[model samples]
Target chain A: MEQTSILETRHLTREFKGFVAVDDVNLKIRRGTIHALIGPNGAGKSTFFNLLTSFLKPTRGEIFYNGQNITNMPPAKVAHLGMIRSFQISAVFPHLSVLENVRVALQQRLGTSFHFWRSTRSLDKLNDEAMHLLEEVGLEHFSRVLTVELPYGRKRALEIATTLAMNPQLMLLDEPTQGMGHEDVARVTELIRKVSENRTILMVEHNLSVVSNLSDTITVLQRGTILAEGDYATVSANPAVLEAYMGSSAHD
Target chain B: MSINRILFWFTLAVLALTAPFMVYPVFLMKALCFALFAAAFNLLLGYAGLLSFGHAAFLGTAAYLTGYTVKDWGLTPELGILLGTVAAGALGFVFGALAIRRQGIYFAMITLALSQMIFFLAVQMPFTGGEDGLQAVPRGYLFGFIDLNDNLSMYYFVLTIFVLGVGLIYRTVHSPFGQVLTAIKENEPRAISLGYQVDRYKLLAFVLSAALAGLAGATKTLVLQLASLSDVHWHMSGEVVLMTLLGGMGTQAGPLVGAVLVVGLQNYLADLGSWVTIITGGIFVTCVLLFRRGIVGELRALWKRSF
Candidate 1:
């Protein structure tokens, strides 16, 4: 009750041709909670994620961050306001060294994103801090390697590290461990736990163990509508949530 | 810098200074001018990954502006070049804005179409001398003091401008803005999610490339005293692309090496006329097939670094 809602959606609806991808959904994410969005494939989870980040414009909705309306804001501006998203797959600059990847995010934060004349090495001042963040994500050993050469799990770790460098008050991670081995999933889950300590995290996760382990709140959508919302135990016990998963699981 | 890099650059500087003494000054000047042009084109293509098929618009327009100002307005060579460069930057701003809204192949097509319109204007404009172009442009004094009429003085001036242009590009590529530009080139969606205004960076790069291309074109006019319709033709645009591709699309020194090879090929094959085009085409095919990273690019790979 004492917690504040940092991000809120007011009757968000997104229509694709004649199909409603998100049908009049409303959500209020608490200021500092690890929230998970779970849905079967084609249940409009990706579309909902896209609309929240402004990557897709909702046919009708209003998004508020803190108290400011962000439904009409561009993705970059939305990110600038401390809401940043990670891709469904790992997204890091393959040619850049891992250190440079984190440094670039920090460099943008320092207001030098448009400086064409300043030596990038001038950002050496951020080297210690960037390495510190890398170390936190268990990526310090791989700092000099090209991101493209990193293993799938490590690439996702680097994505988290880069996103962390943005100093986001709210982070949206889409399927952070989508295609990882069990060990990697554990490692990334731990990394997310560490990052979410002081920030609100909203992630779209299909991995149930990760979902149960990390999410303080779970949002389950079925065909563009909220089917269940609560803590893990309550939602898992819900008869309707079980039936929906059973229906999708049989076909999947 | 490593010792090898220092030695390489030192050798290059020495060669740049003394080559005119051994070679025909006019030929060397032409190569230097194009080296700058190709470098400018590479900034957009190599760094931004925006394949502009009509770079000649910037280069040719700058040349025409410089030629018209010197021949008609009686402006100093420096002022004429300044005007041309500014015009190219402005034009780049407009073109990049319109082009950046599209992605991949669409971006390339948009730029090509817009630059063709510029080509049409160049062919029809009275100031451009139509097909005749503005000719016999005065080189004028450097700051109204040093006479540039002397071929040796002119060679050094062109050489100096070439070095300055290359230096600008080098600094830009190594700069903070350049880092973000490459990020966009690598992954635009990630860049947007990271809060970078990717389109703005693309536009800035476009303007910078245009202005530098303008500088090269204006310098060419001073050296050759002509701005002709041939410069603005779509063929010129394709040639610049070929030069950059032959050099290495993204490497720092690729364009310079590519331009020299291209210009040298033209000079040696000049007596054969049409054979030159055929041979050039053959060389391009070979480069694309065998050394796709380009001559300098392949060399850089061997060296484990970019020149």
Candidate 2:
């Protein structure tokens, strides 16, 4: 195989008080592939995403990004190195206009984020580029609207647009289609597929249809452990995966 | 700027230029000083979403330092103000570093605790004149040519500094730095995930707000020729908060309007003595209950709805 891993975890483990949220689990994500992690509510998918993004520190484990140890790196530094994550909740600068939301991500690269004396007009140069990103997500029509007023689905699109502005090497989307209507789920699923063309995407998705539609590889986690790892068909057909989702009766 | 904004600023500039003739220049100067102070506080609370209950530390520190430098060291008024502002900025740097590690109510409590420490230091420091403070500090010449001793000259001087301070704030609020601050306020985790060091931005905002508050304090000391214990009291910090809350926390003009209303009320209600506090509290209650966005915030919202 010509594929190389873009991210790797070495026995990643996180324990909460006495309960292990993410048990010792080693996982690898191939470069430029859409990999989905699916698990029930208590299966620790959120905790795994948090640990991967450095939002939560693992009790014991190391994270390697692009083959370099990033276990101790800060979340912002992790993001700066081209690994950005989206929230389980829709995250957009609520009061800012949709266009301003994308412009801010682009503005960070100019090294003037700390220049207090300069007028915001300096950011006007990014307007065209921001609009281009918005257009990509089909949010150009809502550019001038405040993000807080956006519909749930549109807000998710705006989140992706901002993530796209970062041009990340790896995008970790935590439940990108969570709580969306069927229409929104499909729209966002397609959007993810489009954005994943040049970037490796590691998403935690409960929507099995979205996973089956977009994931090149699928990993099933059950109670902080990997229950199955393979392509959609192989993982779905696995008895353990079936029992985890259903009950032991299904396997019997 | 929009037509209405230009017109509004033009009106404000004209009123400020001519107000000393109609109203007492001293009273106007006092209001301007407090307005600047409130605006500075708003920068932290409103924009950065960090409620600092100890902002009076910055204000009072600058006032005392400016008073001492101008009175004892024989420094020029500008240099005195500069020293005071720089000292406050340094203090802000320290406070910000310590407090930025906390969030919400904990952050507010830490600032209040730190400021109480300063209040005690003010009481004990020999240079501070204790409760007597530094009184009768001369308003030295502007560049040794224009005498600030003249009330008219002093009024213009205070006015000029107030304008410059507010202008700097306006620029900051509309700048890239301000944008990041707003983002941090709106969502800290998202900002961090977007590769922004949110704590660093919060610290810088804290320092800028402290320095600006110091500038207001130094100017107030010059206008009144006194730096007293009242400046550093926790009450003063609470009053600044009231001013910002009354005006509107995040809006550009909210704190300014709040400061004027507050200072003006205190002046007119001086005959009531201790009752003034009660009346002020009543007004605050009313503002919060009826128009929680503050006067300017409500007005902006109304305008947005209407137009």
Candidate 3:
């Protein structure tokens, strides 16, 4: 069966103070595929993600998810529609126990009302589901530990686990392995791969090696526009992409 | 499994229950009410990181409503309190939505402005009885059986509500919703990227805080048999913030301790008249400058270091 487009954007443009941060960009993400958005620091990758997730409204554009126009929808409504985004920085609730963090997301997804008299612990199914997600992310052993106590890499993993509890049909991850050691990067990479098996994964990554190894399609962005878009090999050889990265390589 | 945690809570509960016997019943009751108010305030400031300068609006509104219902409308104490709580919740829904539109110092200022409006209304409104306030409020009967006219009875009633309110706050903090609020407080941009509706979480926290503040204020009016302008004043809002800060910002038991200490000081210095304000101001300055972590926060730090 031909895979359907899980997320698409048409002529998405976001401008701040008359300067186009993301100009006339179009994107199509296939279901059950890992799509990577690669770009230089100022190429508006973050702004693009913000627009898609409804964090920032686009100056002009249309966004569709599952064949419904969700342009400029609030973040919560978009999330309830089965599209979720994970931050580059760990966004886990630090004071809450690891299990509680996931449980909170699950509660939102489960449509549990916040009733003062009712005890949430009585909801055995929610707890079990949260634990299952934690196990999937390999953080089950740390379930009772407060999220703030978790190591940096494990905190990132917990964030992914929390997102899974939401049961999103499409996941947007921003630089999942941005600041990690080699071992941690590899572990998160594996975790992302496993998660992508169940949902459409779209990520912004600067790590070329990880992007080349994991992405089914790569979209290169530079100067608020698409530099190239194709499979890794095709995009890597593209003159525009080479020029975008090569010019910045000297500084590193 | 955790013996220390269990023992710690047990000890604290014992101390709280025995407090009325050792201290003046009225003072204890006042402290209990303020503790509840402070805890409610902490829900917004510590957990959600949304500083509200208008918390007094909720407290004072609830106090006035409860006083009116019980005194003029002849409603039962429980029903009157419920009306007060509901009124605060309604106010919270509106104010929280509007206040959350801004962040940081802007949020604080917006809340302050809104609260100041309430203060003006209270002063001008005849129902508030002008400067004299709604006085001689009857404690009435609890459940139409227990006589609250008795001092001991009133003390126990206030204590029960205080305990229940604190328990509710504790449960909320441990719940998933509370965790999400904390995440929003710590890093709003990050929480939004996580697909969490950060503003909604914040508004929810604010409402919860307001409702609890209402509960405290209503209970206070019954205990003291009056609802006065003192409850509606901006100073009341500042006092609650000082209590929470002195106890601890994010720690579970911090607000309670702070409320007790502040109330105890007020009682001891009651004869000093306006000097009490100067002393409290000095304490606030001292806490902010020298002991920013607060008494409970410092203790927690020391405990952690030792362990």
User: RMSDs, each prediction?
Assistant: 2.1, 2.1, 2.7
Candidate 1 chain A minimal-lDDT segment of 10 residues: A243-252
| CAPRI docking class of candidate 2 | high
Q: How many backbone clashes does candidate 2 have?
A: 0
Q: Report the CAPRI category for model 3.
A: acceptable
Candidate maximizing TM-score: 2
- The alpha-carbon RMSD over the true interface for every model, in angstroms, is 0.8, 0.5, 2.9
Superposition-based RMSD of candidate 1 using all C-alpha atoms, in angstroms: 2.1
TM-score of the first chain in candidate 2 relative to the native first chain: 0.96
Tens digit per residue, CA lDDT, model 2, B1-307? 5999999989988988999999999999999999999999999999999999999999999999999999999999999999999999999999999999999999999999999999999999899999799999999998878899999999999999999999999888899999999999998999999999999999999999999999999999999999999999999999999999999989989999999999999999999999999999999999999999999999999999998
Model 1 stretches astray by more than 4 angstroms: A1-3, A247-252, B305-307
Provide the lowest-lDDT 10-residue window in model 2 chain A: A243-252
Cα error of candidate 2 at position A244, Å: 1.1
Maximum-DockQ candidate = 2
What is the C-alpha lDDT profile of model 2 across A1-252, one tens digit per residue? 324999999999999999999999899999999999987779999999999999999999999998888998999999999999999999999999999999889999889999999999999999999999999999999999999999999999999999999999999999999899989988999999999998999999887888999999999899999999999999989988887887522210
lDDT of 3 at A56: 88
Query: What are the per-candidate TM-scores when only chain A is compared?
Result: 0.96, 0.96, 0.95
